[model samples]
Target: MKKRFVIWTAGIYILYVLVMGAYLFWWADFGVPEAYEGTGADPATFMTDRQLELSQDYSRYQSMLYFLGLPLEWIIYLGVLVFGVSRLFRDFGERVSRFTFINIPIYVLLLSTLTWVLTFPLDYARRTLSVNYGIGTQSFTGWMRDQLISFWIGTLIMAMLITVLYVLIRRFQKRWWLYAWMLMIPFMIFMMYIQPVVIDPLYNDFSRLSNPQLEEKILAMAEQADIPAERVYEVNMSEKTNAMNAYVNGIGSNLRIVLWDTTLNKLDESEVLFIMAHEIGHYVKNHLLWMLAGSIAVTFGGLYVGYRIFHVVINRWGNTWKVKGVTDVASLPALLLIFSLLSFIANPVELAVSRNAEKSADEYAIEMTQDREAAVGSFQQLTVTALSDVNPPALVKYLRYGHPTMMERITMLESYQQ
Candidate 1:
């Protein structure tokens, strides 16, 4: 069974590398599409040759890092199981606590701590690359602080989830995935509700729009979109990165507009309005609610598939891995490994859905604002500030990007006429 698992893992990793590497190195369609010729939507028209090279290099390295990182993560999970490390941690947790619930969190903490330590090099490499490309400005200490915060937050959430998941597994045995999916609905919504107000504030200071004139203009646009927002919030993003972004976050009363200070400083008033209008498009079109529903559906599918595979793998390798049963806390790595593979497989589909929604939002922004220049300029500014590859490889777009490529967005904006 272990040999088969290793062989399958090798096959999948090789296949992934072959496909992605071919697209990265051999594919060469990174230019403005023929349909958009003479439209002044070309990156060549706005960006210097050096800027274009930098963007492409940044994109390439970042994509490679991401590609390499996924399998490395999978290996880390598999290593713990294969080396008996998972069982050792479980036993230590048991020794530390008499209570099952206490032992579960303790085991999770140990596992997460180990995972964090193993992955820090990959994280550091990503940070170094980002900083070198001028996409990241946060100091190493600040970055480490953020990493620690993220680690704790993630570990806490995983502990809660694993605790509940195991309880469900013990109770239902065969149908735990279904109940877990059901529970995830409310849990997801609650997290979304608190994220903007509670969790987001941990990273940056969010305040009402500082520029009164800009705030008034944004507020008018919000009223036009029927967003029921009296104010726009701005975050101090300049301290961390050079990228620009704006979004609508939260659900119900918590819903609000958030503009990065980087965006406000980089783009002019018309461009800012166009960007905000794009966010409003999301709200008006119910994209968030639809995305939530789609995610729930996808989660249901992943969990069901994972449940099937989990039983098969555990039944085969339980004794070898020293796992007591399906419900054993030590089985966390096995469960995560299965889910990770499922997630990787499902990513392209999720990204495709997201790109469709982004395209819809772009159309809405153009139709609502009727400022093609602003719309086109906003995308151009984004490309320059974020070091975006205007036309990434088709496979990269399909697998990695959640929004339309910068060139695609520019073309769409340029084509839209009043």
Candidate 2:
């Protein structure tokens, strides 16, 4: 018997991914090492013996944890459609059919449940490595509870989206994709605005900034940036992770600059000031808003392309996959499969835009603070602490990096001689 075309196509894509990853990591194009990116000097002299050991260990473990599942995540997700696993869930969705409202939820719930189950092993392994590396302190039960909470939230969103999606498909089968894209614009913005308040707190405890001195410095930056001083907040991340980070997230009243507790405890005052300035740069330049626009563009394009391919796909494999039409809940896997591929293809464009914004933010930070020393010191400390890839391969930077590499940031900072 001849094998299915999707089976062949999926296998080909998997091989392509493996080959591409191998070439990027090993053979095709290399990046300048951080040491070489600077003035001619012994890289060994840059780090103390102890610093070298810890930095290498951190990089080794972090690299393993970060990149290990890049291929497997897509492989398993696509394999479900290529094999018949998706149809199994779709079959169950059909069997559980009831009122439109309950039926859509049932379909979403089953699809999500299967995805979560299949990917749980990767999630668990990553969490285990984090705990082993002293990166995460949350207990297994606590972790599982967080996962359940996230799963519930995701299922809820998908249920609503899927229900509306099918409704659009049934009502306007020809132009459903455009209507879906239009609906997503406002819905996405609303979600971004509300996420910090409603969804974020379910996982971490957030409070008004407590450190009087640090709060003062943060507010001063906010004043210069013209962001409201009241927007500064802090999260108790020490209970969960040892990593240090701060970000300006959300929109409007939901908007705030959040500092991780680990950052406060670990970084010096000057370093924190620089970090805050960088985040403030984001707010000053309205980066979050711009990125939201970027996201919408990517979504619109992905949906359009997915919509084009979806009908052709269903026409070919609809019966085999138990999918009747675009309106059918069983078509969820086909929809997701095409969207995921479009997303993967569009990632480089998304990341390139992000990296440029980050570089611009770095410049804005220096301009805001007028403290080049503090800014450079902050990057040096962050690089060692996070074991950041100072010089990941060129392809990796193009495809995966959202921020300029540590060396790139530091190299640019050196231009601001006092």
Candidate 3:
């Protein structure tokens, strides 16, 4: 059974690699455009010839990292499962549980902690690359401090989740996944509600926008969107990154529109307003609610798939894998591995939904502001300053990208009548 399963997975993996390689070769732009042909004369004016060259170089470098780091992370996870590292961790946790009242918490903590340690090197490497490219400026000590905070916070959350998951598994048995799916809706909302106030400030300092003129303009835009404007935030991301960004996050009273100082410093007034309007569009259109609903639906479907696969795989090789049952802590890595593959295959569907949401926000921003030039110019700036891949490979776009390509966004804005 084990041998057959291994052979089957290897065959699927080889086929996957071949298909992706062909897609990259044929669809990934072999050469990027040297100059812009967007709205106003000389979008190239925003970037010097030297800057343009550097942007392409940076884009290629980062793309290479994505190609390398992404597959390697999954490979490492699969390796851990194949080598019984999860069984070893489960044994350690069971030993620890002898001293504690609950085995699930101990097991979850150990599992999360071990996986985190294993993954940290790659995480650190990616951050190092960002810093080397002049994108990130956080000191190693600061970075470590943030990582520690995040590690603990994430571990606590997962512990709670795993405890509940186990409870569901034991009580509902066959219907556990459905119950977990139902629970996810409110759980996700609660997490989003707390994130702005609790999680975000652990890393970056957040303050009210200091520029009163700019703040007033943003407030006005929020008012237009009918979102609350009293508490806009500016994260001190300038200390950590050069990338410009803004987002509307949180639920209900906790909701906030946060701007990175990088955006303030880099973009002009019109461009900033357009960006803010886009974020406001998300809030005004109730995109968070819609996305949450979509996620709940996907969660139900995915959980069902996981439940089915978990039983099938375990029944075939449970003895070989040293896993007793679905509820056993030792089975987590297998379950996770199944979900990982499911997510990879489901990437295109998820990305399509996200890209559509982004497009809706883009259109909303344009309609509200009626500034085609500013809308197009804002994205053009992102392509230059942020090294956003303007024309990624079709395969990369499907598998990796969450938002529309910068060129697609710029072209969309330029072609818009209203």
- Evaluated with TM-score, which candidate comes out highest? 1
lDDT score for candidate 1 against the true structure: 0.89
Total clashing pairs for each candidate: 0, 0, 0
Ranking by lDDT: 1, 3, 2
TM-scores, all candidates, are 0.95, 0.88, 0.89
Q: How does each model score on lDDT?
A: 0.89, 0.76, 0.78
How many angstroms is residue 215 displaced in model 1 relative to the true structure, after the best TM-score fit? 1.0
Candidate 3: what lDDT? 0.78
As for candidate 1, its clashing pairs are none
Q: What clash pairs does model 2 have?
A: none
Q: On lDDT, who's better, 1 or 2? A: 1
True lDDT of residue 300, candidate 1 = 98
Write the residue-wise lDDT of candidate 2 on 78-146 in tens digits: 566667676676666667766777777787887788788987887998788778756678889999999
Q: Model 3 clash tally?
A: 0
Query: What C-alpha RMSD separates each model from the true structure?
Result: 2.1, 3.2, 3.4
Specify the poorest-scoring 10-residue window by lDDT in model 1.
31-40
